[model samples]
Target: MTTGTTTGTTTGTTTGTVRSRRLGSTEIVYLALVGILLVAGVLVAVRGGNLFAQGNVSYMLTQTSLLGFVAVGQTLVILCRSLDLSVGYVVALCSLVGATTMAGDPSRVWLGVVAALAVAAAVGLVNGLIIASLNVNPFIATLGTGLIVKGFLDTRFKGPEGEVPFAFQTFGYTRVGPVPVSTIVMLVVAAVAFVLLTRTRAGYHMFAVGGNLDVARLSGVRTSRTLVLAHVLCSLCAGVAGLLIAARFGTGNALVYSYGLDLDSIAAVVLGGTLLFGGRGSVVGTVGGVAILAVLDTAFNVLDVNPFFKDVLRGVIIIAAVALYARRQIDPASRRVRFGTKVSAVRRGGVA
Candidate 1:
């Protein structure tokens, strides 16, 4: 709810009551999450089980961390009116880089982390450079980059390779009072992303570019730099996910690509109510979206739903999300035609 104020020359001031504002998308997402939890709890109770069990909650958080990292990155890229289909490949590749650098050596963990992030950032740089410099369609540019990485993974790596030290493994598995450290890290990353998008110059420029490229360019925004920065940050997040993967698995598995993280990450971003084509969205809503997916996964497990059915349900979710926001693509404020309104015989107010 909000209010409006007006001032008149004769009258000192005037106020008008405005209609209550609708809930924000982020708020709606959390409310939906609560509703889902309540409903899922009831469904689980029917089977003589409790969905709110600490273990179950922790498990969901654990799973959320994995997808959350990539999804956060996806959120940034999508907000910039750009896309990176190569994130899944980056995650998988970074896992290998981190693990292989460690090579079972505990002392080299920092080096491994650096190596992975460097590789991830490099890939992001390439993606940004290609799209921004060449004016390539983001979808096609990212897809091509992803395919290149996929090819490298296929030919150079046959299976899992390298190892992670036990010390690092704890980074992935450690828990504090029902919360996994990895989840905490993910939330921290989200916080950073939120701040970047809401509080910084780069973030403002990103939204401007995504909102209207020509307007932003005319406004003196360094459009290319902004896009490149978004891509770099996006890939960095994926690198973190890779680190988590290596820590958890104790080895880098090239097969991580099969997890379909690229699409899953995108799904989370869109479900958060971000404009599909770009420009308008928030990371807070994205976090809520990730939580929603986590809750659904938990619900599915409690209900003993078949694994295959989960895919079907996920398909329905992605489609529904796209359908929900598709209407926004058309601007209602634009001129509408065929309304039978009388007009002078002129074109755009000029001589006919």
Candidate 2:
């Protein structure tokens, strides 16, 4: 019994040590992004550009807020070991649907917003049901759903149509001093997401479900429900983003921002150090990731970099981020440390 106690104690110490070290490594990635942002700002400044200028900063925040909303949703879906390719079109559809509802009268703008959210929620529910119940590959399911959304939009409208209410547009443009209202919205969403993931039971279930569905199920976690919730929330985020877009532009365009938004949001989530395989991530990291992309994109424009090359650079960044995280995941030292503790626990007659 004494020997078992000693072994358990040692195992606990080893596990704690490993966790601390791993956390440090994760923090480094976020800090590195901060450094990158500072460097990018300096480079932009060196080129006689003011990255910190009031106007530019406001613009960056507004744009980042839009992308950030989608990225936050992507983070949740990925955390559940699922993907939401349908989000891009969800944005387009919500924009069109909501704008269509509000076109007749400005007083009905709130109704349009509610209608857009309902559409988004319905689409998300279908996605969750199909993938969770049928055991369909999340990637394939979401992609198919996305195509369907695109088809619906195509058949419904040829180009930009409908008008957003003037008041709604004004709200989108409202600024709190130098900060835009949209940016405030983004920050609030992020804060809520951060709290949910880090401080709530549902968040814990999501991470567990993402880490291992079978284990989560064995633990009475209701893995299917968790996954469905993730997708639902993801769609809601997309819906909000669509509304913002409609308000910002005062119209909905089926073609606008259709191509890169999905990829960009995924890239931002990955950049924030969230594992693509799911389970391990932070909303703060996602925020950092979004800022990195925003900084780079802004820098590219200010530096006169070719538009074509920006895409290439973005692809490279995504690949590099994935590779870096993969390396950390498979590191022999970390793995051995984690595995060793379990092995020791088992030898001591404990359930590893």
Candidate 3:
């Protein structure tokens, strides 16, 4: 009986160790980045003297709100081990189409909203179908779709032409108590995403598919459907963001948010420790990542950093984050090799 009890305790300890190890490097990077962000915010606050001023804080929140919308969708896509490069075009095209349809008519804005969502959903479906059915690489498929969307937008509008209704602009500018409505909307979206990922059957299936597509398939999870759903959801998120952008600016500019938002969203998602390969991540971590990016940008502007330098810094952060993840991927194989080499050395030593 004592032997069995001892064995059981040892097994429990082993299981705990395995679970802890699963989050090893990812957790380290996440915590480290958080620390860095906090330190940077402090330094900027001291230097700028307005980092936490109500107005500056509101501006930061507004900026983060826009990027957060895109990051949430990017997290879902990456969680499923897929990419949606079309999101940039999705934002541009949706905003342009919706604004043009509205033509500054407040009463007709709902029609524009419907058109935007429909186009967004259709784009997502095309991405899903082409990648899942045709077995095209997601990167290539989304890229192609993005180009097509961009082409359509270019043909429709040579420049920013349509005006968003004044009533619609309120959604992007209103403040609830002390908070921007955009920020509130982002919080709601993040909360919904968190619950969906943690509580729903579909979310579980998505993670399973991302972790191991073959295993998920064998276990009766519909991997193809999960992939399709992820892309569709991502596009829908972009559509929402596009509409908000149009309302905020009161006009649609195809070139305004075109590509920068995509790169920023991806960078934030990756910085939050979501593996680009998918299968493991947290929406909460993504929230932190988005905040970090926003804070840095805010600080840079306050400090009057050159635009070129800001771009370089962003590129460095993204490359560093990706490299850290890549290192983690190589660790298990390298550990096995080391273990085998050590065992061989022990055998030779014993023989000698």
Counted clashes in each candidate structure = 0, 0, 0
Model 3 RMSD in Å is 4.8
lDDT by residue for model 1 over 1-352, one digit each (tens)? Answer: 0111121211221111111233556776788788988988999999999898998999899989999999999988898899989999999999999999999999999999999999999999999999899999989998999899999999999999999999999989999989999999999999999898899999899899889988999999989998998899999999999999999999998889889899888888888888767799999888888888898999899889999999899789778767766754553322222121113213324542
**Candidate 1 similarity to native, TM-score:** 0.88
Ranking by lDDT: 1, 2, 3
Best of the candidates, lDDT? 1
Put down candidate 2 lDDT per residue, 315-352, tens digits, no spaces.
88879888888777765655665676677767767543
TM-score of each: 0.88, 0.89, 0.85
* Model 3 per-residue lDDT tens digits across residues 1-352: 4444465456556655765667654466568656866776687777856666677677778888988988998889899899888898899888887888899999989999999889998999899999888999999999999888778777877898688999999989999765899889888999999999999998998899889989999999988899898888888889988988899889887985455788788888998888888898878888878887877787788778899998899888778877877777765644654565566556656666
Query: In model 2, where do residues sit more than 4 Å from their true spots?
Result: 1-26, 334-352
> Which regions in candidate 1 have their CA more than 4 angstroms from the true location?
1-20, 327-352
- Tally clashes: model 3: 0
Tally clashing residue pairs in candidate 2: 0
Candidate number of the best TM-score: 2
CA lDDT, candidate 1, residue 183: 97
